[model samples]
Target: MSNLLKVIALLSLTVAAPGQSQADWQSHESILGAILEQVESNLRHTGEKYQIDVAPLDRRLQLPQCDRPLTVARLPGTRDLGNISVSVRCEGTQPWSLYGRAFVRLSKQVVALRTALRQGSLIAPGDVELVEKDATSLHGGFFNPEDVIGKPVRKSLAAGTVLLPTHLTTVKLVKRGQQVAIRAQNTVFEVSMAGIALTDGEAGQRIRVRNVSSQRIIEGQVISDGTISVSP
Candidate 1:
């Protein structure tokens, strides 16, 4: 009877203890780190320089080890670059999901004035410099230096101030009452006419013009400094 009892004890030990049936599962840290790495890689693919800050998951929280590699993805409609949430999931038999938040600080090279600029001062390459700035912080910031060059400032701006789209006018390509060559084009054919602009317009902007020969008012897009186009 004692031998039988000893044999039963040995059998219990050999059968494996409860909760030790499978390999140790992944820790919360490892899973969270994997998710963060995927998020960083996705952000980098956008081609914008950014400093990423991912909020850490609760250190004490327990997570089951995934037999397969864990999958990480951004939540739908969470495409914005600022504070955002991502989904981390394990597709194994013990499936689980969690949301992680990340703060992405995007940076860009934006145009900034090198010298104090007064209202009506024309912007030149020499007067502006491309400076690295927090992209999210600058509302309506100007990116292309050429877009602002030759544009007159609408308000006085201090030296080193970041340029905004609202601070400059679109360089006027056609002036009111100026004679402009009007070109009408389509897939089939092209035609040209002489017209007088009745309203000022920048390149690609629609403006009112009068046909010089017909004396009929028409709307056309300013194609260049001295040219406009109308659809027939």
Candidate 2:
């Protein structure tokens, strides 16, 4: 065959190659879709209703296509939810990698006040309610109501305000001048007596109590609400 004819044939064959046009370059949408899938999988345990918004890549930039499947992974130290970055990589013939920035929002039910509460007010079921909030913003959102029930507020809080550990105080189980059952017991025997709490205290806190029968004052640990246990 003539050299000119051979050159023309080779050029034609290259242009007609199957899947070549599709494989020549990578699209931004494909990369963003891969990132969304991976970020969703990683955040499955973080929350159920999760929203992901991957930022659009630079319009002028172009990336080589990969022959192998693309991979997405969270950047080191990336948070479970919030503005995060993921490593998007291609291990094909033309290896390439880049970071994709995305904003992740997760929703969850958190404890919130149903009514305004004053400082030192004890929490009750009627005073609080569950409200859906952005889990990413709630740092440590409380799910169970029992955690805050009966706990006193640290300061005045407005209605509809989310409840956090900083908003509540340790549950005071015993109160000063309140009648409490004083019990002293061992593995073999037990004795029960009536007493008056001399000071307010929380569970495991030691406070003075006066024996109602003997009129003797002694210190004991607050075991439960209206209950104190003493040792010999």
Candidate 3:
């Protein structure tokens, strides 16, 4: 009789152990899911529509069941888009912390080459077209077609490739050893002179030039093709 009682007690504990573990697993998933949903909600409220992808929780990790709701927060310096991680914590008697990764994608219209482009090719309105793309994964693509029009390609790009700042450059306006107009202005007066450019420069770039009349070397910003402006 005594042996039978002992065996029944052991069997009861064995059956109840698995039930408790299952409950803990469910609680763990609930907490992690809530944290990821918060991350998605925050991204959606940024005024831009985003498609969020969250990684699945590791099945091997077992967390204790919490009687209270879990606390979720973004890691320090986290942005609203791209791949990021969030921290989740349980503040109940059995406390725990975890980090989860999520990917946020925003759709944007960007400029891409309609056909294969060669290095030094001038970008024309017909050569590029606007296409909807994932802005987060563009790796810094040019969104405005106007910003790239007339710019020279720095390297060859394949068809359907997005244009990036590193892929294009402004046309050089001031070539080395060329004569250019130098304009100087002050609060009271303005002056113009002829100067020879010592270095090649594009519009908005600063370059060195020698004034023809004064025989003075000066640094000025290239304002246009064959034109440089110096401060008074």
Candidate 4:
């Protein structure tokens, strides 16, 4: 077993009094284990390292043996680590329920700005940095350097500000400096040319495209990530 798991296992024997009889009462150890499992399930594939600690159940409570299996779940709106409330319910012959508390600390390196930037300013290599933060404190989504660098800020942000997808505006169709296929079509025939994108392009937005064959630049509407269609 992992050191962390071993420690938590050792704690299972320490709760209540040493000689206290738990034969007739609901097992507090099992309840804590269930909460840990639920949190681990949620953290799977998240790429964040975490630690968990659950409060020991009160020894004075006369919790009865649950004839059926216990059901455990994190309460609504309490999914984001830190301090969380969980419900442990028994639906056996004599129904019973109790609230438990646990703390989850999740950590990950996220992209943030090194200096304050104004809205619409393009991000440069020196403008951004990576920092470790509690993943639980972040809402929505976070970003990496590659996701934010060379992109324009949607609004002004202060130094050390973490970057989220909502903070940046990027190519939905075409990106700057990328090769694009330009197509022109008519009832008689159709022609296509290779071009270099001069700026990011969006649907119905005008963008400059440089034709590789003629070495001439023309405007076109974005059709796809690598395709731009022009009017004849």
Candidate 5:
């Protein structure tokens, strides 16, 4: 066989063959073979650590179990590199392995609260704040207090809201350049409130529609027109 196999065989013979009977030697060799196979497999493979919820072995586990992605605190080394440790966690599920794939417990961070304050950009529990050093550099500047202070921040921004610092900084409250739609087709029209009117439109939502053809203003559902209608 190969040199490694020969070496192991000789070593096993020296350690156990003399002390045990012939049958015992055969059994030990079989175990050695299995261990060698595992070593060889590990040599050729690579792995990473992921925390996931594992189902208990006692229960019937299902495939494609949706689990939260774990926050990776550390990473493993390459197949032939540094001191790597494949990390895995167990979730509420137990046992973890069916045949080979097992669910591991994992932890995730979520942004609970977010706002721009003069002190710096405020974030909730899991939000990660990235800081850059040079503004002119390709990475640009870090999240600064001036950038977020006095800026409208959301307690819970929608999925559409960009979380990146660059994108959030460029956002502004709709003011003069805001585009408004008019609604006139529906009878249940309403108008903006008196104090809340951003423009000339009255607040409290009164139905108002302006006919382009006759240049006449008609009162209707303020919101039903699908566009902002004016009082006629």
Candidate 6:
């Protein structure tokens, strides 16, 4: 074939190539949809404009609600959850959802439950289990302060208060010798050390403690002053 002809053919092929597009989220979208419905239910059922952000599907979820400006550049389905934005903020009904349904709120932010627990909110009600490592932020963009609010805003959380947001995957007690433990359910954790309960150890609180184990005062949460069990 003539070189000119070959060049023309290549150019034509390049132009004719099919372009790729975002995929549908499908059921994943449904879950998020449900969450949004919940928010609408609480938000007095009015559509509101909110922002939404999404993380890479593979990224581990850290926040409670999806980020703002939802994107689906990675997954399939125009309506699927695989490709959407996290950190979402939208305004519609108090709680809104597609077929999936979700709830949202304008005043209350859907932060990680772990963050709420840290803030000293009771983990009951409004708390939901994380489904997978790769999921949309939240189905809805708003929430009712009353329904989604954590336990009373604690000026400080006692050591024994259980930690939520299990993804707090990386927690290091700062004190060199402080003891630490994971408190859950309603049981008082066992004291793991004898070091001076650093930082006024109290009930349902995690404080920087010095670990008496190695005589190194390590930062630790005071599950319950001197009487609580410390996770070994």
Candidate of highest lDDT: 2
By summed lDDT, the worst window of 10 consecutive residues in model 1 runs over: 8-17
Give, for candidate 6, the lowest lDDT window spanning 10 residues: 55-64
lDDT of 1 by residue, 64-149 (tens): 66778888888788755677777677787666666667787888899999999999899988999999898767677878889788
Judged by lDDT against the true structure, how good is candidate 3? Answer: 0.79
What's the number of clashes in each of the models?
1, 0, 0, 0, 42, 131
How do all models score by TM-score?
A: 0.75, 0.74, 0.76, 0.58, 0.18, 0.20
Output the lDDT of residue 25, model 5.
22
Q: Is candidate 2 or candidate 6 better by TM-score?
A: 2
Model 5, residue 12: distance off in Å is: 43
Q: What's the lDDT for residue 158 in model 6?
A: 43
lDDT of 6 at 140: 52
Across 12-129, the per-residue lDDT of candidate 3 in tens digits comes to: 2212245575655435458557866888777665565678777666554566666688787888998877877776666776666666667788888889999888999999898999
Score candidate 5 by lDDT: 0.31
- As for lDDT, the candidate ahead, 4 or 5, is 4
* TM-score for predicted model 1 compared with the true structure: 0.75
Cα lDDT tens digits for candidate 2, 1-232:
2344234323322222355564576888898899888878877775368888888776644567668899888879998688887777777766677777788888888899999999999999999888889888785757888889888999999999899988988888999999999999999888889999999999899999999999999999999999999995
Better of 1 and 5 by TM-score: 1
* Lowest summed lDDT window (length 10), candidate 5: 94-103
Candidate 1 clashes between residue pairs 3 or more apart in a chain or in different chains: 26-65
Expressed as tens digits, the lDDT of each residue in 29-110 for candidate 5 is 2332333333334434323222332112222122222143211122333232222222222132221211111222212221
lDDT of 6 by residue, 45-79 (tens): 43333333321121221112222332212122333
Report lDDT (CA) for all predictions.
0.78, 0.82, 0.79, 0.79, 0.31, 0.35
* Rank ordering of all candidates by TM-score, starting from the highest: 3, 1, 2, 4, 6, 5
lDDT of 6 at 201: 48
Total clashes for model 4: 0
| Model 2 alpha-carbon miss at residue 142, Å | 1.9
- Which has the greatest TM-score? 3
